[model samples]
Target: MKSWRDSVRNVVPYTPGEQPKEDGVIKLNTNENPYPPSPKVLEAMKEITNLRKYPDPAVSDLTEALSSYYRIDSSEVFVGVGSDDVLAIAFLTFFNSDVPVFFPDITYSFYDVWADLFQIPFERKPLNEKFEICAQDYYGENGGVIFPNPNAPTGALLELETVRDILDHNREVLVIVDEAYIDFGGESALSLIHDYDNLLVVQTYSKSRSLAGLRIGYAMGNRELIKAMSDVKYSFNSYTMNEPSIVMGTAAIKDEEYFQDTRNKIIKTREWFQEELRELGFSFADSKANFVFAAHESIPARELFEAAKKEKIYVRYFDKPRINNYLRISIGTDEEMQALVRFFKSMMNK
Candidate 1:
């Protein structure tokens, strides 16, 4: 008789940033927004009294709000728990072919995890020496493609021309442009969607809109692609979003003034932090995201990571190849960033 253990499928899981429990810790590891959600979002949450009933299976209200904001048809929008949920469904829906999906070797770590969990074949194309994606590398045939616009950990932005080139080369397969950090500085590929029917542009409220707690993310593409992903999503879970998220997310999108104010603040802080890091002998690519990935000229990243923890200052340090010496420091409020600079100055002086 065959043992049940033989049927088990195992894969390495994705590790998220550490969420420290200590109070007064200057948390900056996870790249979370350093601001609160819009006041309108708070008001909307207070109005969500009907929790006894299940949420709309279609998530129509939030979907319509997103479509209106982006000036797209409702049929072109697909909402999910977060960008991760949207991406996972995309991988499962479009990457069933035998050909391998292509993404950067240094992209979002979840790409590989999702591919593995879904048993989809994938290949990691190496980024150039500058840690920027080479569009020519993706010119070859593949099942699908996905990469973040400003990228993660590296914060390198790929311009729309190059994005168009990639889309131009692989017109037969679906291409996903993950714009989680686009609001920080980089241009979004949403405009290219009308030109490239195979394109799916995914964005999140977690970063710019300061709505990570709401777990709201959506994708814009042609109606066909949106319909396919929605079908897959409904098959798995009809009510993936709760009533609170739908109401709060709709409010968050409508408050354009507050959204712009918070994101602009983070962008300004990131620029200031980058300059401070440079002065402290840290070197890195000019980041377009809300975080700066830097490496000290003399000290090791692990050393700085530990020293910051001792001071109750938190930042992300990856123990991976090529980027082992680098630290991804999330942009916080002006005061928090000033505190981080002080910690670095004190540590370097020691």
Candidate 2:
């Protein structure tokens, strides 16, 4: 008789950025917004009084809020626990073909994990030398395509024309644009939703709206695609979102002024930080996201990563190939960035 353990499924998990428990550390490992959620979100959370009842399984209120904010119909929006949850469901719903799905080799690491977990075949199309996605590479045959705009770690933004070029080629299969950081400085693929039925644009409040703690994420696409994902979600979990999250997420979407203010602050800080890094002999692509992927001319990234941690400053360092020498640093507040720059200056002086 075979043991129960032998029947268990096992796969490598996606390792997330470290969350240090201690206080007084400048945490920037995960690409989380350093600011608090909108005032409206806090106010709305105060109204979530009924803890006894189940939150709406459909997540209608939050869904409607996103729809209004994006100017799409509610039927074209699907809400989830986070973009991670939403993208996982998308991978499961689509990518059913025998051919391997395609995405950037250096994109959000979770894409490969989700594909592996779902037992789906996938191929990683390598980004160019500059860490930019090559549109022609994705023109070939595959199961489906998904990549982030202003992609992760590298923080390089693909223009809308390039996005359309890829979509134009792969109209037969679903193309998912993971826009988790679109609000930073990238033009969104949301405008192409009506032009291409196969397109699904996923965005989250975590980065731009400071709601990572609430785990609010959503996808906007054609009504048909939205229905398919919603159907799969309901089949899997009826109430993926709780009452507080639903109310708070709705409030976050409604506060457009606060959202814009915070997003601009992050972008400004990111630009300033990049200039500082360059002055310190660092090289990186011009980033449009909230973070910068940089490599020093002489110092190894691991050394800098350790040195920064010792000073109570945290940033993301990927030990993967190609990017092994690079560090992805998130943009914090003005004072936080100044301190980071000062730390770098001290390291150089040594």
Candidate 3:
């Protein structure tokens, strides 16, 4: 419609993984934590008595809590509704120049959407045949750079040295390392943020802390970069985090014991499932995230997706080139994963 702004009208939005609400459907499409949040978080959420006032524009409590947990200065932290919001604001705040930003051809699908929506030039540097990012490919000139550590869907991780190499090459332009799944089993680039002025490392509590429902994500970077992001956030929306989310997020970060227990459980389950897939003749990358991207030796990924859906099981299937044959299966509870293994065994043997 001509009534709409030209930017909104021409944009092709990012498609997230499906969220099926029906009972009995084992939801594993979105990489959400299958475990419940800490009891302390639930208790804190129940204490949201003040609904009359707006949340803190600065998101003070959660920011302070995250700062303490990560042992970083509060000025170096920025919080938003989710990593999506943080990343979106980042795209707007930075990536303004005409020079093309660079990322993996098979990385988080949202990167391209953000670039297109904002009219920022970008190039998708192809990953090697092994689905691993080549740090050298990101070496040349660019406006900005961003990629997921343990890159999504494939879950292939670039070592810390490789990450440092890319940062070394792109010192002038902004570099964002989206560590959305880093809690699963990968070294975070957060340690490099202190050294690289251009580095901004983003993470979410949705996975490890089991706070997806709270919708809180944060970034750690140099004080200057965080100030720019904060300015953009305030200009767009003064109050992003809700009272309940802030309180609950603060409580979740404090429950270190529960967080470690749940994360360890998921990692153990992922390792066990990886062995099961190997025995089933499936080929996959060594995923460090809480998901497994694997392809069956005989059965097509598309067919497996459909068959699993019929069984009331939902797994992520990307209908894109180079990765269409693979299934991105999020690690569910031990019992849920075992059920999936049994189902795969039956279907593959048949």
Candidate 4:
């Protein structure tokens, strides 16, 4: 009998932070915005009552808005489900058996999982002692390069100059910057498209736009690079993205004022939360994102997370080595933060 199975055996799925269904726990495991999406987005989505017809295959309107925002040509953009899809496309279009891809060892864990799923060989280059991506070490002969700016968990930012240097020095290599978290604080590589044809910058409306549930993301690059990823997406699922998402995302971009206010609130909350954590004898990475990475000398990250859950507050804790000592707490509303702090203080006093 012929066996029917996939090459899925060796692949280990990426584990996102624990999300519990209990209503009492303050959900902060995923780095989702604590605020609601722009009112305009909700209005836009409501207009899509007819589900029988298909969405625009090209997603022309949303891409046009993104094109103007990033100041790139429309041909240089490809809209997809999320930044994760854009990254998965990058893996399919660029990574190959001929040469291995390279990324920071401590970067978004999903990158490694993507490589394994595609059977693409890859190597994890260790970040510098300061946890910055070492451009010098990345010049080795490889298939392509990919990493996140203001990387996940660590929340560290790589300056634009450093990113440009890496691109210039490795001209032949395809460089993909996952900018999912960059909008919160870091500079975007969307500005480098003119100089580097091989640079692919991925972005999501999930973060700054407070549209995590909308599942809208796009990529910017030279027309050819964008076209390559499109081919992969088109082959598998031509209309994978839905009509309501497009209507909502396009409207969200058009309403810049609401987006800014929401982003500003998140930034304010992040800064204030960082200060409060510091006062509680915690040390952590200098965050350049919507989340704060912190740890106190007295409490283990796992224990802190468990204790917070008991108080109906939940934050993220990765059991991975090195990072196991730290918790990645998403910046929530001021009241939510105060509640978390109050619980921590009471736990300590007890």
| Per-residue accuracy of model 1 over 283-321 as CA lDDT, tens digit each | 999999989989999999999999999999999998989
Clashing pairs in 4: none
Candidate 2 lDDT over 147-187, as tens digits, reads 99989979999999999999999989999999999999999
C-alpha positional error of residue 309 in candidate 2 after TM-score superposition, expressed in Å: 1.0
Q: Which segments of candidate 1 are over 4 A away from where they belong?
A: none
Clashing pairs in 3: none
Assess candidate 4 and give its TM-score to the true structure: 0.96
Candidate 4, residue 63: Cα displacement in angstroms equals 1.0
List the RMSD of every prediction in angstroms: 1.0, 0.9, 1.4, 1.6
Residue 15, candidate 1: alpha-carbon lDDT? 93
Residue 312 in model 3: lDDT: 91
Q: Report the Cα lDDT for residue 44, model 4.
A: 88
- TM-scores of the candidates are 0.98, 0.99, 0.98, 0.96
lDDT per residue for candidate 4 within 1-350, as digits (tens), equals: 54656533766788876767777668777888889998988888778888899988989989998888777799999998888888888888888657888898878889889988888888999887666788887878888998899888788898999999888777887999999888788999888988999999888987788888889888899999988888888898899888888788888988888878888888888888888888888888789898988879888889998888777787887778667888888888888888888887887873
* Residue 306 CA displacement from its true place in model 4, Å: 1.3
Worst 10 residues of 3 by lDDT: 1-10
lDDT of each: 0.92, 0.92, 0.93, 0.85
* lDDT, residue 76, model 1: 95
Candidate 3, residue 330: how far the Cα is off, in Å: 0.1
Candidate closer to the true structure by lDDT (higher is better), 3 or 4: 3
CA shift of 14, model 3, Å: 1.2
Candidate 4 wrongly placed segments (more than 4 Å): 5-9
